[model samples]
Target: MRREEVVAQWQREYDSFLQDCMNRDWAKIARADEPNRDWAIMFEVDRSFINNAKSLLFTIENRLYDVLQFLLDKGADPNSSLRRYNSDRRCYESTTPLIEAVKIGNLESVKILLDNGADINFCVERNLSDRDVYFNKTRIRVKEPSDDLYIKPREKRTDDEKMYIWKYSTGELANMSPIQIAYNYRHDNIVDYLLSRGATMKVNIRPSGIFPFPFTTLGEMLRRCKLYFIKEVGLCEERYYALRTQVREFESTKKLLKGYEVRNAVPYPFRIVSTAVLLLDNSLEFKFQYMALYSLFILEYWNEIINSKTHIAAYAKVDDIGYLICWLVKETEYSKSTRQSLGLK
Candidate 1:
């Protein structure tokens, strides 16, 4: 028989078996398998049937296990190359059965795939080509900002340009790890599950692939919390002032009121700043200075300045003159801003 004829014959037999299964005529389906060579494809690369099985598993259909068992018994490959399967218009890159299970949040199916040797760290292509074609038709041209302190102005857009930008930004084109997809979708349960299973949340994966500073998981967690006001507060006191210096230039004078508000909310900003300054006295460095400035900014916003007496006491106790200079410069800037705003100086 020709390939087309064989395919047609296989389709007939597979359809009959599918109908029997749907009608709960298990005996008929069991007896339906015959000597048709085309029918063998049902046990080989019937993408539609495999997708149906996937859907059944996702929906917790009662006969899913039986269907899966039957397919396996007939020689369906669990790790079959998805490139050969043509079914509903789902992306071919996402054809992994394990990925389907993950998308459906079917823990049972996931376990089954894992037990059957599915790759846990599999990297599937995302639908970038489609997005690229769409974007090519309507690209936007953005202009660089004229000033560092202000937000950059967006270029005027035609409808096509706007649509292109929206589609390009919203499209899922890059291959994301299971953990990243879970996070993107706010699937907290899946996120926790993947983490517990040893998935690492790497920030950079290009060129040199440099991990962010303070690389420990705990440090990363803390960074996400945004609670650490300054490098000095959580870091060694010796380097605190040095770290503060680096971030000082980026401070926004216009946003001082907001900074003061933040300072008032937390552990008094004064104590926080003092702690950082103390740390800076011990370890002076540009990184530490930058972190210290961040802490100071938080303290300023919170309005948590220490009284002069405590500030002086802490200053006197620290031995490093250079550290004091950096601390003094930050204090001077804060003082100038506060005085100007409050009419104190």
Candidate 2:
């Protein structure tokens, strides 16, 4: 690729990351034109990236786990508002870090955020209403006019006052609960983990101007549609050991490749940023692409080396490999930080 092409690629990914449906203020604006969303946005708010290269690189490495842990350990409020004072817009917008983390599909980061008291019930309404709406043609409305689910005067409503639908004060979908974000993004392991940690199952999926049912949990959505957020996070007890086994297998396979007279063959490291970039475009069928990449890196590289040299050279682009290694250094530093967190070796 030309220098300009490389620059453009970086620009595209950066633009996507900033205005990503996850981070942007969806607080009640209709997302009619946004193809990924069938739901209308009720409002709009501007968002900007944390552009400090040092800081962003830190996050890309720890994937936000380190900063989250540091904050939580220091008793930083987990439910803190993400108030972004856009000097350009001359306004303020805020959402929680948990919502951000869930959108990015960072499972470990989300786990720490949840454990530290992030609000499970915080909701960003897909669309707001001046009047009550029914769900699935059912007469159940949000139970009150001038609906404001963010109301904090009461500790808890009775069971009769069921969680009908998400309501937002900020007027953006960025306020969506962590679990809903996870499920929408098809982060199955994250969705499951958040539910286990008490994230609410209720999410609003009703089409706008349609009769909205006040009560619908994600569990209900799962039943309503035969969709799957399926994932296997591997063994719990063997998290460390499993990674070791993987490295061992990687080394063993490397030696085997050498014995087969495969020269200059570098096994692809399964670093998140490096590998995840390949499948970023094909997010809906998330896991399948990931599995394909894993197989290609582990099993098919040598075959490509023997049979299709041109494709192998393209696959192992020097710039791409360097980018992966640059990102990998952050992970190594993150591991050191995590080790300190656990007071373990």
CA lDDT of each candidate? 0.41, 0.39
lDDT tens string, model 2, 1-345?
Answer: 455655555456445543432343332112312233211122221111232222233342446555446435544566665445546533343556666677777777666766777677665433232133442233222422123332222236543333433332122222345565665576767766765666564433233222122223422322221111111122233443344355345445443233222334433333323233233445423323233223224333433343321122222222332222222322333366543442223
Error of 1 at 40 (Å): 8.1
Q: Could you estimate the TM-score for every candidate? A: 0.40, 0.33
Backbone clash pairs in model 1 (N, Cα, C under 3 Å; residues 3+ apart or in different chains), count: 34
What's the lDDT for candidate 2? 0.39
Error of 1 at 315 (Å): 42
Please name the candidate that would achieve the greatest lDDT relative to the true structure.
Answer: 1
In model 2, the Cα lDDT at residue 343 comes to: 28
